[model samples]
Target: MSKDTSRVRLTAGRVEAFTCPAGKAQAFLWDTEAPSLLLRATPTGRKTYAFESRLNGATVRISIGTASDWSLDTARKRAAELKQLIDRGEDPRELEKAKASHKAAAKAAATAHALTVGDLWPDYLETGKPKRRDAWKPRYLEDLKRMSAPGGEPKKRGKGTTRPGPIYPLLALALVDISEDALKEWHDNEARASKHQAARALMMFRGFLRWCATKPKYRGLVDNEAGRAPAILENLPSMKRRTDALEAAQVAGWWAGVEQLNNRTASVYLRALLLTGARREEMAGLKWADVDFQWRKLTIADKVEATRTIPLTPYMAQLLATLPRVNEWVFASTKTLSMAVYNAKRRERDATQAGRTAPAGEVSTVSESGRMSDPRSQHAKALLSAGIEGLTIHGLRRSFSLLGEAAGAPAGAIAQVMGHKPSATAEGYRPRSVDALRPFLTQIEAHVLALAGVQFDAQVEPGKLRVISAQ
Candidate 1:
């Protein structure tokens, strides 16, 4: 009922005895020691410590804390600090906002700093580069992605029967946790069922670690030496590099059998691989745009150089020209199969925008697969028909090199045609132009045709069907 007129030294006892005015919306007790600091209570008896000051000619008031949480001295100190800030023409609210922002930023940084390798893998696949090659080859990129895939189905042996990814378990581990011991454990487990695949996976993972070390975001977070640890390294099974090549005597049988294949496109695709010595994926992923019939050259995806142009020999041109143009793919297949193509770039672009999808209709290069399928069984069937045995699909590529050599083409010429960097001195001897390589490719094709006991008049224009004249 009566207005209090004096300032008081605030205390626990004073604070406990303070009462709210029944008639007023709020009441205040100004501290005598700190005049600007006050204890305010609502009519319902809710109390808090607060500070008041004039800022930019306007009275600005700020709530400090409740009487229970903050002592009298603490409130006084806060009031003084606010007073000084106001005197310096600084807004206390801006300072508070800045402090809050800094705290939030620190929390966000902590969250990001501990990002797992799995967390960064997707973006890295989209943008990260490895030391082995400039951009990731489609096959290698697919392997990296599938390695960490959260597996689509359950396994039969483990928790259940499904094909889980090899690297899926490691996804939960932080990038910093990929130590030598962790890698050893992973290697031991993987080796139990598939030693060779595990060895390959470990090698791939090492490259990933090296890539992580180069990134500022992941620097010092990965111990790349983990993959090279002696415990894991010693367990790696020694694998012999396969050197299967098509024998000159077998080319005849191989050619006859490949010609009899039900899938003509696949048949030609196989022979093309052998004829050009091109990598399997490169030949399978061939686009119509990459084929320059006018220039008699085929531009193919090269592992060593990203891409390279090989002389499209007369026989090879005829084979390609005879095939139907299903889409952008030169060896287009109508049959549906799972595609392991689309690299990080395609996948990333797809995630951002919906359209511009892969080879489908006009945009699509091949069918579900952008490249040719492995023709192992079909090739085997052809081989059996031709009375040949024990020839693997990849042997066709080796055949091209061997046959090229037998035909007197230099090692450099074969390596260049095969999309290899040419480890031999023969391949390293001056770059062979498409024109220079043409003769050797043509000669190899002729010799293979002769072995098959079939002859073609390459003088005829490519893609022109030869009809027998009626007598």
Candidate 2:
């Protein structure tokens, strides 16, 4: 028995090989039944194991594990295993794949037990929230709270009972534990209650789960469970047709109703919404600095990035002039008298955070001590008082757009003034001057006032009209 000394060892400066017995070298090289192992050296002097065998009249070479872990005995055993598979007409590659898959499955199952939907939700929000233009973060958190099931009801009568929303039942389940059956059940139940809500909740959940798969801790858990949930059937109820915009005639009636509103701040806020074609929040959140009275321009900080400047019509300017300068807010709350109130108390904190400040005057209304009320709440009250039905502060903005278009404002001009993306045609031309939009905004305000039959000045008062309650 002689060692061929033709093979290289992975360790530096070591070489070993095997020489077949006489008449066996060629037989060993070409025979499918016999397994042979060799060692090779690279130009860099690194060594590696090379196992060779003949299968179906073709020679194949495979590297057993690296020399650091593959001792001679282990290498020989691996080679023997390959030889056995070849003899049995089975590929050694298939066996390796099967073993790998089994190991992966076992590891995934072990990790899945520790991974929950709650653990992966924040990562999903961080990734997906940037893609939407709306304020979806607060909405998403609200949905999460709704989806979180309550332990029990409250004890007091006036206190609201704590109950989990429809999606809450599944939040406690691990990502891998959420089977198709469970998801289908949740979907069916949510759809049965309110298909629109169910659809939205499912979409958020699916997005969260997809994001989970990208993270290291919850990767395999999401891959197997969340990815496998069945798609919800589209047999849910039809959605209500949203009155997103008002028609020419309806705009008149609605405006007429708005004019009858008695609340001074809400009236001004609603008028601003119509005059600027700004979203409810943007107008409600307006600070005095955002308004350039000298220029007659209102700068609206949009929900999306970028600020838009809308030319204030004479009517809107006059409306602004009517309000006392009790606070930094253009629409200061009468309740606080010092601070501006918007949407009543609910949004007071948000208003303050948005830089609400006391005006350079003593507080007169509501004991001169309390913070201002939210203008949005006051706007809602005014709308209700004016006998306006099914119209929100946002509707006032939509009405402005529709009326602006009706008044012959160009679509691009309307979109630009409304803080929408400029059309391709408009982008090619130089940005339109603020003066160019002045006539259109002026027309829109006049149209709204005419519809509401409002008399901004004593000279404009027509015959008296009876007001009716919306309720």
lDDT of 1: 0.76
Clash count of each predicted structure: 12, 18
- How close is every model to the real structure, measured as TM-score? 0.60, 0.57
lDDT of every predicted structure (CA atoms): 0.76, 0.61
Worst 10 residues of 2 by lDDT: 25-34
Candidate 2 residue runs with Cα over 4 Å from true position: 1-101, 109-116, 129-171, 176-181, 184-199, 206-237, 244-253, 333-335, 338-388, 423-433, 453-471
Model 1, position 117, has a per-residue lDDT of 74
- lDDT of model 1 at residue 244? 78
Model 2, 330-349: lDDT tens digits are 66655555233332343555
How many times do residue backbones clash in model 1?
A: 12
List candidate 1 segments past 4 Å from native. Answer: 1-114, 122-128, 132-139, 151-164, 179-181, 184-197, 212-223, 229-238, 287-295, 304-307, 324-329, 332-372, 385-390, 422-433, 451-453, 463-471
